[model samples]
Target: MITVRPSGQRGYADHGWLRAKHSFSFADYYDPAEMGWGALRVINEDRVAPGTGFGRHGHRDMEIVTYILSGALEHQDSLGNGGVIRRGEVQRMTAGKGILHSEFNPSADEEVHLLQIWIEPAVHGTPASYEQQALPVDAMRGRWRLVASPDGADGSATIGQDARLSATVLSPGEALGYALAAGRLGYVHVVRGHLALNGIALAAGDGAKIGEETELHFAADDEAEILLFDLPPTH
Candidate 1:
């Protein structure tokens, strides 16, 4: 079964400096039916104005991953990790025990566009950690690039959950296929342009939940970027 979450149907918040759309309950936005999918808890598409960002916040027992869609995002955490993640980089932070962090748009004039994702950890109360990896544009062009996985398979970033996350940037008419093992579920989020997932059209900011399906297909209608997750039934 496949359920589509329409772009215009998501919870929206415009805080002047920060405009965000949440696929799941976040901050002050709450929707019981849209709470989350499987082990994937949050998928927030955020656009931060220049010189503005999220202040230091606390998190625990969550495996957070950041994927910059455009521009850049400056990230700093209490674990002493700090850096800028650009369009081709993926950042993962495991707030096992606890951690405080902040994200900002450092540019003087360009807005920062990114996706902040949270997945439940395999085991709680571990130490906090951080890792970032560069995903060159050439490698992701027209194909799925494994960005996060439980075992860091295929050089992807490691996560504390039994999940695998992959992303891709596809040109018009390009396509990718994903096969799911029995009992495995999938979720897809479109970042830009458009796509047809098994004949279901999806535009930017749209999300889909998949279940009891053995295979899925993604074909880009235009230049499109998307994130795919393989997750357990629950966090």
Candidate 2:
């Protein structure tokens, strides 16, 4: 079965300095029916104005991943990890027992666009950690590029869950396929441009929850970028 979440139907917030779209319940956006999909808890598409960003915040027991789409974001955490994550870079932070972090747009004139994802960790009270890696543009063009996984396979940032995240960029008329094992859950998020998933059309910011299906196909109607998540069933 596949259920589509249209982009216009998602929760939206405009904080003057920040504009955000939430795929699941987060902050002031609450939806009992949209609390989450399996262990995938949150997907926030955010745009921060120049010189503005999220201040230091605390999180625990969640695997937080950040994908920068444009501009640059400066990150500083209590673990003493600091860096600027730019386009083509992925950041993974494990807020196990507890962690403090801050992310801000460093560009003086360019807004930073990004996606922040949260997945429930499999274990609690583990040590907090952070990792960041640059994904090759050529690797993702017309193919699935592993970006996050439990084992850090293919140089993906490690996460504390039985989930795998892959990213792809497709040209018009290009197609891709994926196979989900029995009992697994799949999710597809269209980052930019138009695409069709299993014959269903999706636009930017749209998402799809898939289950009980063995095969999946993606065909681009325009130049597009997408993220696919393979998740374990919720207990």
Candidate 3:
């Protein structure tokens, strides 16, 4: 079964420095029926204004992944990890026990657009760690590129969960397909542009939840970027 969630139906918040759309409840946005999908907890698409960004914050027992869409974000963490994440880069932070981090837009004129994802870890109270990798454009041009997995398979950043995250960029007329194992759950998030999942159309910011579906197809109606997650059954 596939259920669609329209772009405009998501919760929206506009703070002068940050404009974010929450696919699942986060911060002050709350929706009882939209809590999450399987182990996928939060998908926050954020646009941070130039010269401003998120201050130091703490998280625990969560697998946090940051996907950069444009500009750059300077990250500093309590674990002594610091770096600048640019477009095409994926950052994974395992807030096992607890961790403090801050993301800032270092650009003076360009706003940074990114997606912050939070997943429930399969294990808890482990040591915190971080990993960052730049994904090659060719790898995702017309196919799903694994970005995060439990074991870091195919060079993807490792996560503390039994889930896989993949990203793709499709041009008009391009199509892709994926198959899920029995008893697995699937999720599709349209990062930008328009596309059709199976036969239903989805625009930027739209999302879909899948259950009992073994095969999934994506056809691009316009240039589009997307993120897909294969998750274990909810606990």
**Which lDDT tens digits does candidate 3 get at residues 1-110?**
99998889899999999999999988899999999999999999999999999899999999999999898999999999999999878999999999999999999999
Which lDDT values do the candidates have, in the order given? 0.91, 0.95, 0.94
| Models sorted by lDDT, best on top | 2, 3, 1
Clash count for each candidate, listed in order shown: 0, 0, 0
True-vs-predicted CA distance for residue 78, candidate 3, Å: 0.7
Please give me the total number of clashing residue pairs in predicted model 2.
0
Q: Please say which candidate is ahead in TM-score: 1 or 3.
A: 3
lDDT per residue as tens, model 2, 54-170: 999999999999999999999999999999999888999999999999999998999999999999999999999999998876799999999999999999999999999999999
TM-score of 2: 0.99
Better of 2 and 3 by lDDT: 2
Question: Cα lDDT for residue 234, model 2?
Answer: 63
RMSD of 1: 1.2
Per-model TM-score on C-alpha atoms:
0.96, 0.99, 0.98
RMSD of each: 1.2, 0.7, 0.8
Candidate 1, which ten residues in sequence have the lowest lDDT sum? 226-235
